[model samples]
Each structure stands twice: as C-alpha cells, then as structure tokens.
Target chain A: MSARRGAGVALFVIPALLGACSEEERAAAAPAAPAAVASASGTLDLELRDSLEIGLELLEDGSLRARVRAPRGFAVAADGAELSGVGRLVELRESEGTLYTARFSGAPVGGGPCGAEPVSLALSLHRRGDNAFVAGSLTPYCGADRWHGRPARTPLRLTGELPALAAPR
Target chain B: MSPPHRAPLGLAGAALVASALASSPAAAQEKFALAVFHFNAQYVAGGTLGFTLLPDPELDLDDPTTEDRIVTESLDPVLELYERHPSWGVDIEMQAYLLDVLGERHPAVLDRLRRMAKSGQLDVVSFHYSDQLFIAYPEEDWLRSQALAAETFARWDVPLGRSVFCQEGQAGRGLAARMVTAGYRTLMWPKNLLSYQRSEFDTDPFPLYRLGDAWMVPGGRSMDVTAGSTNISVRWTFMDDGELLATNDMNPYFPELFRHDPASVAAYEAEVAALEADGYVVSTVDDYVTHLETRITPREAPPLLDGTWQPGSTRAVAKWLGGKGLWPEERDAHVRSLDAAARRELVAAETAATAAGLDARERLDSAWRLLFLAEVSDASGINPFRGEMEYGLAHATEALRIASDTLAEAREALGLAGLAVDPESDAVTLATGADPLRGAAVAEAPLAIEVHAGDRATDTSWELVATGHHRVAIRFGAGDERQLWVGFPGDAAAPLVTTLALADSTPVSFDRAGFDFEEFWMALPVGLLSVGTDRFVIKDQATAHLAARIERGSGDVVFEDQTAPIGETATWVFHVFEGSAVDAVALAGRVNSHRRIER
Candidate 1:
C-alpha cells in the first residue's frame, strides 16, 4: 500500500488497538503496529494548536523526528516523559501534504516510575494552511502496574500550523 | 514637617553623643536590643537530593515530609522559646513560603504563630513572597512579590508587619522608594552599619535614619543633611544579627543550633536573661522603630549604599549581579533568559486577558507564584546546587507556558493574530515609523565595531540579516574568545540611560562619569543614548553577559556580548524610533519573537 493509504489504514486501526483496557495493561501488551506504516521523506516546520513551533522531519527509514526550535526553553515530551531536546519516533505513517501518524516508545525521564517498562505515545497530525491540528494519547504502559487502578491514558489535543518554509541563507 | 518642641541635633551634637555613649557603660545599657529571628526552610521548589548536601530527597513545595520535618524540628523549638518568654517581643522574618508550608503541613504550629502575632509577642515580617533577589528584578516583580505576600498573610489571618526585612540582607537605594510605595514604614536592615562605617553615620553608631530623604537622628534630635526625591518618610534601623556574629562563632539561628547542642541552648538562655537584667529592653524591630520615632530625633542618613551583609563592602552586591559569586555563567544566563521570558509573557497574558475581558485570576496567580519561585535568590547566588538552578529554570519555563497558554486563549477569543510576525518572512515594516539600516559598516569604517577578547581587541565582521522600516537585524561573526562590540554613530556626550542603575534620579552622562558600563540581562535590558534630537536604544535579547558601555573619548555607545559556547552567531535587533525607548523595546520584542508558546 502507498504511504498515504497506509496512514489512512492506521487511523482506522488505532481506536481498535486502544480498546477499553487500562493504558497500563495495553502498554504491557506489545504495541500493535499498523498493517503498513507509511514513510515520507521531507522536513516541515509545524506549529502546535497552542502556537508552539516544532520542526518535523520524516526519514526514509520510516522514523519520525520532532524538534522544538522556538521558545528556546521548551522540551518535547512523549507519553508525558520529556524528550531530551529532540524526539525520534518509529511506526510512522504520513499522507503527502495532508496528515501523519506516529508512535513513540521510551522510558520516562525526570518523574518517578514504578517500573522500567517503556511507555507508548500515539500521535496524529492533520495539516492545514500554516497550521496542523493534532490529537494523541500517552499510555503509561511500562508503569501500568503502579497505577493501582487509576487511569493511565492522557489525551493530548494540539493545533499545529505549518508556516511557509524559510528561504535558505 | 518637623515636630514641635523637639530639638534638632546638629551633626556636632550627634558625634558628641555617639562618643559619650561609646565611652559610658551606663549609657550603653540604656540602648535597646532588637532581636530578630530569621527562619527559612532553605527550600528550593522542585529540588531533588544528590545535587547538594540535602538530607531530604525532595525539597519541593508540595513535599509534606520536608515541610513536616522543618515545622517540627527547625520551627517548633523557636516558637517554644518565644512561648516561654511571653513578655519578650521578638521579630520573626521569613518568606511567605515557610508560612504556607506551616499552614499546609503543620496547622497547629501555624496556629501558635498566629496567636503570638495577635498578642504582639512575635511580629511576622515578610520582604517577599519567596526569598527572591528583589533588587535584581524589575519593580513590577517587587510589587508582585508584595501583593503575593499580602494575599498569603491575609489567607492565614496573620498580621503582616509594617517593617520589611530582607532575609538575604541585600539592599539598593531604590528599595526604600519601592518599600514606601508598598506601604511599609520601616526597613530593618542588619547589614547597613557593616557596609557604612560609624563615621559615615556622622559618628553615631546604629542610629535610626529616614531613608530616601537621607535624614538621621541622634540623642532625640533630627538633622536633614541630604536631598532625595522619595518625599515619603520611611525609617531604617540597623542591628547586629547572629549571622554577622557567626564569624565570632555565634550561631545566628540559635534555636536551630540549640536544637542539636543542649549546652548551647542553656548558654543562649542565660545570655538572653543577662541582656534583660542589664536594663536593656528586648524589643522587636517594630517596637524599636516606634521608640525611635517617639524618643530619638531624625538625622541625615549616610549615603545609601547598595550591598548585602556578606563581604562587608558596598560592592558586595556586584557579586550577585553577573559577578564572580554567580558562577557557571552559562547556566546563569539561561536561567536569566527564562526569567525574562516568563516576565514578558506574564505581562502579555495580563494585557490579553484585559483585552478579552477574561476572569483569569486563579490562573494568573498560579503563573505569578511560579515566576516568583523561579526568582528565588539562592538559585543563582553563591554555591548554588545544579539541581536547584535547573529547578528554578523549570519553574520559569512552567510559568512561561502557563502565561503563554493564557495569552493564546485570549488572542483566540479576541480574534487577534497569534504570531507576532510571519515566521517565514525575514523583513517586515514596523508601524512605529522607525527606519531600518539598509547598509552595514565594519569596525572603524562608518559603523564602529569593537571586538574584545579579555583585555585585547580582536578582528570582527558583521552582516545585516533582515531589515524593515522600524527594525534592523544584524548577525555578528562568532569567535572562540572574542567579545562582540557593535556601535552606532551618536553623541558620546549624550546622556546614557539604562533600565538598571535605579539609584540615580537623572540619566548618567558619560562626560561626567567618563566610562559607564552595565551588563545586560532580561532583568536590565534596554540602554538608550539620547543625543537630544535623536535617541539610540540598544535592545539586547541575546546572552546575559551582554554589556553596554558609553565611551567618553570615542563619542559612541558600544554594546558588548561575550563569546559563549564558541562559534555561535549572535543576532541583535537595533530599533531607531522617535518615541520612548520603552515603545522601541516593545516593538523590537515583537520583531525578535520574544514570546513563544511551548509544544
């Protein structure tokens, strides 16, 4: 399937994968990969819905890279765990000039964790003129057992904008 | 304004009285000893163990274990000492953070404190909401701290005393004016006499003097010796504290010290009893000030100097201001940037909220609280822990995020453009009618660029990256050891005015001062060289070590940015406009994109 078609397929498959089970249990279970994850190669300057700017790059190896450029102080996070400067994600899928979906798995940093299990983050970005609206959820799968029956899924709503690319100096 | 029937003691009479009191043991006994106990948890928000020699794993504001230990071990013994001596009035100076921690973790202890304060046995004094370096920040931040302290004290139903006490013992000439505006009547400064000698006080040791107007009194007579702008009458009394005596092996926080050493507690108790038995009135600072007002006359205060208690010099505060004491300059720079950005965003959020008519009281208060916590003095002061510095930066970043979110929502509600400028566009016209530079000049050519590495000058290059009607962006070449200096053609004799230098009422003239220089941070950003007809405002948005100097002989204002992280280009926006430098700074801030929401 084409990268665009694969991304569409992943969009339909994500909810079914999430299910009604708590995030910890689902996170403990292997993160289900889409039927065919799409990969597109290019760099796009994207702004979150709240006006946070991020530089997004899609690599040929089907990995996604997000870089925070402006607001020199901000740090990107995956599943509530702060990323060190740049965040790299796999199981990536993207539609040309339209949308993208990606998942990141990492051991949480800074905050206390019950276990060493890596949490999972599923994110989707829909591109518009100079803006990209995003929706995603972070699952504390690694430390799911420590939740003690508390909900572990954190929903994220981000509106992003893809401004006109700057001319090379 | 002189009171009737009160004799005005001239400078001679003050000196004579001081000499007589110094020689006479009987007169010395008549002097009142004001005892002020300073309590601090030494708490740094979001602090974690391992970075420093902290026994607790976390010193976070929300950590109950740390709060409980401080309340039970450090504070309870002190309160007990006060309780044992009901007739003794002592001043307790602390940050509102400790009070808040008491209210949350140990309410009973807080209640005891409230009762003591109600009965005037203990006077609760707060200089800031958090123990911040207020002089290092803008006056707005100082006001915010006062407001937050007021709110906290009101919530706890504790009396916030009229006297202000800086726990850090740092003071600037501008502090008295700010305190007067904040409704404070007295400043209990323990370090003043240390910075200024007895002779500086007209030979009267530890005399009560009215600040700003510079009046001092000796032996119940007032003398006005210097002129000041802050007409408001506020008094200052200097007392010797335990910290000062610690060099002589005296523990300042005796309650805490006595907790570990029982032998010392008995000795301290005996010393207190002896002091009372010797005809000395053990009084709080408030009572001492009241006594001074009623008994002693006012005299001309010595030159109000800027310093802290440590090092015992007027230049001591310079160590806290980008000096040697504030080490690891890179981390300090980053934290300073975060603090500046947070303050800017907070103002923007407030403005946006007002424009959108949003009732964002709770959210703004939270942001302000975080910002104040970020400004805590210990984070950047002498021997700061790495974890504490990062924690402070974290608070600043969180504050920025909260304020940015509020601003974004307000913009959305008001249907305003969120982006300050087109992110893609390098050039855009400003509505302020300020013209941008179309051409560039190198060192000693048309535009003078002076690059220095340590004491020697170095080679330099520059380019105009972007330009508009009101703004010009220049990117300077980077070198490993070079300090970048960019200058514009203007009158060297023109008055140089900086956002810092709060002591002087008039703009500093380079002609008079010869060479005037100041290191710029977000705390002190703008420097304008006004040439009567035209004004040149250098708005620094780069490193914290950016220094602006006005050379008397060269007839130019030079901006210096030290090389950091080596081989990184520094871009500065110079705005040439007709209006106030403040307006120019605001416009330049937009062009430089100072405000950004976090992702």
Candidate 2:
C-alpha cells in the first residue's frame, strides 16, 4: 500500500551508501546487518498510536526503495505537535552513527485530514552499533487513525513503493 | 440432592466429556494407511507426454509411439478394468521419473491411476503431481507438486486427499515424519518391504502394517497374489525392490493370495462381470481411502516414511532458495541490484512504442509485475517461484512486445551493473500452456514479436512452460479468439494448462531442480515468445526463423536467421540464451585465513 504505513517501529530509510572496496566492503557493511530494532525513545504518545514505521533502504544515489511490513502500534513513544495547515509536514531526524531526517504528511485523499487541525512532530533517528531505530511520533488529524491491527516488534519490511521510488511497476 | 439424581447427572456429564474428547483435534490413530498412486494423465516434460504405455505390449511392445495410443493403453484401460468390475478397489501412487524414461511404474502411469480412481476404486493416493523424489526436491516444491496434482486429479472426478510423500523411497531424508506434520495419513503405497517373506515354515504374505498410519505397498509377492482375492493387489517387484503388477512371464504359484489379501477376487470378478453386463458406475478416491472407517474424513495424517525411497533430485534447488532465510547482507545487496535493473527497464520502456500504442515503459512494467509475483509465491525449493495472477488476453500481442523490450532492459541493466548478461537472449517469454502444464514456464523467453513494424506483422514472443509437443490454438491479429490446439508438453490423454493475464504477471516460473520440462512433443497447447539482439519488424504472419541457441545458462535463448522471422509467429514466443545444470562442489578451506596456531 502506502510507504508511510508499515510497522510502527523506527525505520531508518536513509539511502544505502556505497564504499568501493574488494570483498572488504561486504566485510565492513556485513556487520551492519539489518535488524528490526533494539531500543526505544520513550513511551509512545497516545496521539501517535497508529503511526507506521515506514522503512526503506536509502541508496547512495539519494534514491529510496521500500520493503514493507505493517506496524504493530504498542510500544513506541510520541510527543504531539500543532498543525499549521491541511498540508502540514512533520520533520524527522535520526542519528545511529550519522543523522538521518525526513518530513511526512498525509495527502488530500478526497479532501484533507478529517479534523480541521492535524498534529505533526519532529523525530530523531537513533543507532546503537550498526542498527538503526526510530524514536518519534506524529499525529493524524482523525482520532480514529491507527497504525495497523497489530503492533509488530519490527516494522513491515516493505519493498518497492517508497515515496521517492518510481510509481507502481 | 438425592443420591440417585446426582448419579444420573454424573453419567450425563461423563457422556458430554466423551463427546468433547471425540471432537478435539488429535493425531489420528490408525493401524494401516492406504496410499494410492496419483499421477497426471497429461504430464509432459519437454514436449507432449503420452500417459499410455507406448509400444503397447500387444502391438509395439516398447516405448509409446503415438501419444493417443499410449494414453489409451497405459491409462484408460486400468480405470476401465476397475470400472467394469464394481467390486475392485484402486490405489493411485504418486507419479515421478522423467517423461522420457519408462518400463517401470513411472509418472506416465497416472492416466491409468486416475481412470481407476475416477472409476471409484481408489482407496489411497499420493498427493504429489510429478513423482519428483523428496531428497532431490525442496520441501516447498514437494508441497506444490502434491497440491497441484491432487487438486487437478479431483477435477477429473478423482477425490484427492491433502497430503503425500515418497516415504519409503527416502533413506535418510525424513520427509515423511514431517509429512505427518504437514498433514497426510493414508499413503497409497509405501515403497520397499516386499510381500510374502519366505522364512522356514511360516510363509507369511507380510500383512499390511502401519508406520504412523501410512500403508506399505500391497503386502504379497507378485507371484503369490490370489486371483480370487480383492483385498489387496499383490504386485511383482522392480529391480530396485518396489512392487509392481506382473506384466512379464509368470514365474510359479500363489495366484490365489489376491482373493485372501484384501477381498475375495471372485467377489470382485462377479461384480465386474455384473457391471459389464450393465454399464459404468460413478466412483472416486474418497470411497477407497475412507473405505474402512465408518466415520469419514476428507484428510489424514501426513504420509509416513515407513522407509520408502524415491530418488533425491537437484531440480528443487531453486525452489529452496526463497524459503530459507537470506543473510541480511545478501538480501539488501540483491535488492539494490534489482532496483537498478528496474530503473533501466523503465527508461527503455519510455523510449519505444509497442503495437498496442503502449510505450516500452508500460510493457516493461507488466514484465516486472509478473516476475515479482513469481518470486513471492513462496513455493519453496526447486526455485519455488510463484505468481500472483495471470491477466487474460488483451496483451496477447502487447505482451509479446513488452516481453521483447523487457529482455533488452534486463540485459542492459544487468550489464551496466557489471552483471554478466548472457550472450544469447530472446526478448519476451509468455505463459502459453495448459493446467498441470501451466505455472511460470518460460512462456515467452526474451524474444521480439516482429522484425519490422507493420499492421499485418504478427506480434510474437515465446515461452516454454510445461514441456511437450503441443498445438494450442492462438489468434495473434487484432482481437482474434479462434481457438486452436497448440502443442505444449503434456500428456495427450489429459492436458492441463495455466491461465494467461497481464495484471497478474507470473509468466516466468522455474524450479531448475524440479526439471519440470524433462519431456517433449505431446498433445499440449504451448506458445513461445522470441527476442533478438536487434529490433525486429514483423511483415507477415509467417516468420521463418531458426532457433540456434537454447540455453538456461544464459537465462535466455539464441536464434539464427538475420532479418527473417523464425517459426510461425503466434500470440507468444519462447526464447532463451543458454542454461547448464549446476552442481554443488565441496570446498576445502582453512577456518581462518589469518590463523596459524592450533590451540
């Protein structure tokens, strides 16, 4: 479905960087195994209950691709923010070893968010060793919005369907 | 409360508890499982496979010559034999072995098995389609083989059970114990152990026993089967020790055991004679496997190993790849490569226009969708590539065009990434085979529809799904539906084909280890899509082209004939480069390249 919707866990969608080496690149990046998550920021904000962890593999080309797994929204922390307009954008930042950031918002489906005001929040990416984790939350305008049926330990492993990725194949 | 009232209440309570216990899901407790034989009457390897035994014992006395005769002789008769006799019971074993080989109870024997099972004599049957051995096949492919075979058999009026395995044939691979876990109980015939062991005074025709409920082959020497008994069919042994009915010269005595083995043969004969005196009656697999139990169930425990053995095949290797967990490093890297390929594809598509006015980009998108679906089905082992859907018609011509463009995009993308794109490759391959015969065969390998662009040019691409000599009906012009019987690789007696579609792209299906295409030239409806190194423009319906290279090694096909079209262009084309069997080699390596001391 939508790239923004997936496992509610912190998904580091930073483009993957390339370091040309012999098999050495693999050896170095080898230890950086893709794991679900290891840490959390704090208790999830009640408002960000259903926020998906939209994960992606950020390529060095600044192009992103997604492999998705839906989010299970039970154990993440979120702090609500005030919305400016219908197209309000929420900024996010992360630092496992390096800082990664993105801004997310809903589109005008039939119209816009159900409520007059939508909540947005800024997030920081965290990484312990080589593993990355998302630790922030955003609030959709509608109170009925939910991440998914189940809050998974790991966000949905999404492939293709990223915002920056090409339209559906 | 009165003592008498309490006692009555207690009794009722106990009864209620018993009922609950009965309904609770538990491993079935059975003494013997009836594993019948199951095979597709129309299984074709490389071309059309004749289910009937060829070189009829009465006529040719050898390999099947005519596909129809082989079907009639080997398959139809067995069912007819049972049908004529209302009292006889049938057991269908699984079909295995390549279509090219014969002489034993090979997969081609399914026609007879199905006919008999269809006649209402089937007692137990293997759930698998082609009798690919478990050792050689990946677990997922084995599951599909069983699923599609049993499901298809059911369509022919043969009731199918849910589980099966070549337990006896497997010496070390404990697939049967897992079969139980997978859900199957009564096996038609567990291999190995013979009928009637000769030890001193006690000459016992090894009675039917159970290894976790799966039945062993009918328990009696082929020579000892009592002609009057109908309880079990005492079969002769193969060179490898599997049992078979006596088709050779009779040896000695013991014809009387068949009557005493399972049921009285005299009773069966009387019923058969009675039926022939009348006409055909309706029957199926359900009646047989559940023949004994008063309470009938549609399924049983997993097939028991019971020490049966089938050959271990390597054809299932590709199927297994997707099932096992991939290292994160490998998976991510692969994804990266796939992305690059996809991007190049999009670019190539936009640059060109196909016959349908659909740009190369649009067709390429369709190709990618199909590949994605095939990759995700999770069939396991044998490169269990799966497909989501098979979009019907509309693309019949456009599909070929897309297939052509996609092939070039794949090569260009792969090459740019420094990936070695094989030298030989056709553009598009579409799915052009029937059921049982269907699946993601190389429908249209990478090939082009026409050499020159024109309205009269026949848009063509090729594919090779289930192998066999087939003549499927196809109309490649603008909106044509005149049905034709194109040849695919399937049994002429009974043909199975897959559906076609664009939105649901699952065209390129392959389980290398499965060797699904091991036979050729039967009454199968097949289509092929072709591609070339250079752009092709079609001028006429007849395209005179010659296939020079056909290799899986190159992941595409090779062909000759400069600008001239090859073969008769159809709705689809089947092309490829080159392919070779891959073998695993053991490697000797040091535990650590830096280590020197042995602690």
Query: In candidate 2, what are the lDDT values of residues B1-599, reduced to their tens digit?
Result: 00111111122122323433443344322121122323332121111111123322233211122223333333344444455544434443434221212222334455555444444445334544443323321233344444444555554444443324342232211333444543554333322221111121124343332434342223212322221222222232121211112112211111211112112223434544453233212222233223222323222222221122221232112212211222111121112112122222222333322312343453354433322212221212222111000001111112222333343344344333212111112122221222221235245433322232233244333434333212121223422221211221212221121111110111122222222232211000011222222211111111111111222222232222211111212232222222211100000000000101100
Instruction: Give DockQ for candidates 1 onward, in order.
Output: 0.05, 0.01
Specify the poorest-scoring 10-residue window by lDDT in model 1 chain B. Answer: B229-238
Error of 2 at B241 (Å): 12
Model 2 native-contact share: 0.00
TM-score of 2: 0.27
All candidates: TM-score: 0.60, 0.27
Sorted into a CAPRI-style docking class, model 2 comes out as incorrect
Alpha-carbon error at B171 in model 2, in Å? 7.4
DockQ of prediction 2: 0.01
| Docking model 1 quality class | incorrect
Q: Which regions in candidate 2 have their CA more than 4 angstroms from the true location?
A: A1-169, B1-67, B94-119, B154-157, B161-173, B177-183, B188-599
The candidate that wins on TM-score is 1
lDDT of each: 0.45, 0.25
What range of 10 consecutive residues in model 2 chain B has the weakest lDDT sum?
B583-592
